[model samples]
Target: MRMDWTALPEAVTKEVANRIDGSRVLPATAGDHAEIAATVAGARGKVFVKAARTELGVRSLRYELRVSEAVSGSHSPAVEWHFEAAGWLVVAFEHCEGPHADLSPGSTDLGLLAATLQDLGGTPAPDARLFVPSERFGFAHPAMDGDRLVHTDLTAANLIVTTQGLRIVDWAMATEAAPWVELAALVAWLIGAGHTPEQAEQWLAQHSAWHEVDPAVLTFFALRNAEKWALKSRQGSAGWMHDLADWTGQWAAYRRRPAN
Candidate 1:
């Protein structure tokens, strides 16, 4: 269901407008159960807003706000600020220009993205309070360290390359997870887009440390992500899901097989 911004609690709308220097507000895009992507006029910047009417949505929105706040000042370029007023949570961020007409695993954009993740390794974990429990790891590996703040959801739509550098937008699903988790997710995403395993491995080799992690561990995370999209595909959830399940099952079986 799409939210009518005009009907948003006046205070929430006012706060968002005021933060953007009173820019003319225009709707940008809507996703899943949230309405987002608003352009702020004067500075020509954009702010993304999410409002939820259901109990689950409200809980998730709160979690997103917390994650945004936790990673705010870290070197990672994520959502800048979050404000809650009148039953809405608004996050303001510097807008990024183009995803470019062409974006792929081998694009220079991916190179820049890899470089950004490499730099994030140096960012200090802000506070322990923001640490989400291990079981809350989502797509991240449960055994991986949660010290560094992670974007968790680094899908193509969330990234944009601007004159400055790569800017990651959309923090609704961001969380603190293993540093390699982001890298693993990126690799998995490339595979799902049809890049061959060899190609994915080559791309991942660019980040040597991340590549050195147990291949099975990395593949497990990758396969889990693949199963998620498979479930959502229109072709029929069972087939795609089964394909991933079978691939993993076969991998497990082969790992346990006796030496030939």
Candidate 2:
């Protein structure tokens, strides 16, 4: 959830200070999760820093750090440094400068994002405790099974549109799933970004890997995703959960529509 950057504990601040020379902490207004999210600039350059003290938050951050280490290629920003300070686990990554990807129709970012996803699909799944589609969506099909790692969270916010191409951030929700699941998960975002369901699928068809997913699996994913987001929005409606609930519901309904 979007949160104001409060002053860090003196000891925590001091510890972070000791690590980066002439560091300046700038508050971050984006991102849904993270206890402390900010940009730290110093002698070297800017690094996006995310720190967490809560047990769940710390564990998630550590897992993401591990995943980041295993992931290679220019698609993801490199990890800068990470350390524990004042009981909080702080991790930093190369601060990539760019706006969140534009998924709307007619945006050039669509191609860049597609290329990035294709590149990321080639990264082998690291030896880690990873979530399967059923573990996350409560329903899984044979088509969802694969050895390749996929970034389950395809929200535009996680995709930075840099000059070189799109750079994906936040590996906290990365999962082990079929390559197609990566693009399948992006359908809702396309709808949310103003594409009709048919249009979204047409765009997805441009990728050869997308042709491999079973149509039944897409329908199942849409149903479960709609249900999942709806439940979460009811519990806590902030931080784009409600938006996702709406978009997923729309996609599901569109998929269920009768043949014209």
lDDT of each: 0.58, 0.82
- Candidate 1 lDDT, tens digit per residue, 103-221? 36557776777777777654555563444524444444554665766665565666667777777665665545666766665554455555555565577676655755676676566
Q: Candidate 1 — which residues are off by over 4 angstroms?
A: 1-4, 7-11, 18-23, 30-33, 42-46, 72-83, 100-105, 128-142, 192-194, 223-260
RMSD of each: 5.0, 1.8
Q: Mind sharing the TM-score for model 1?
A: 0.71
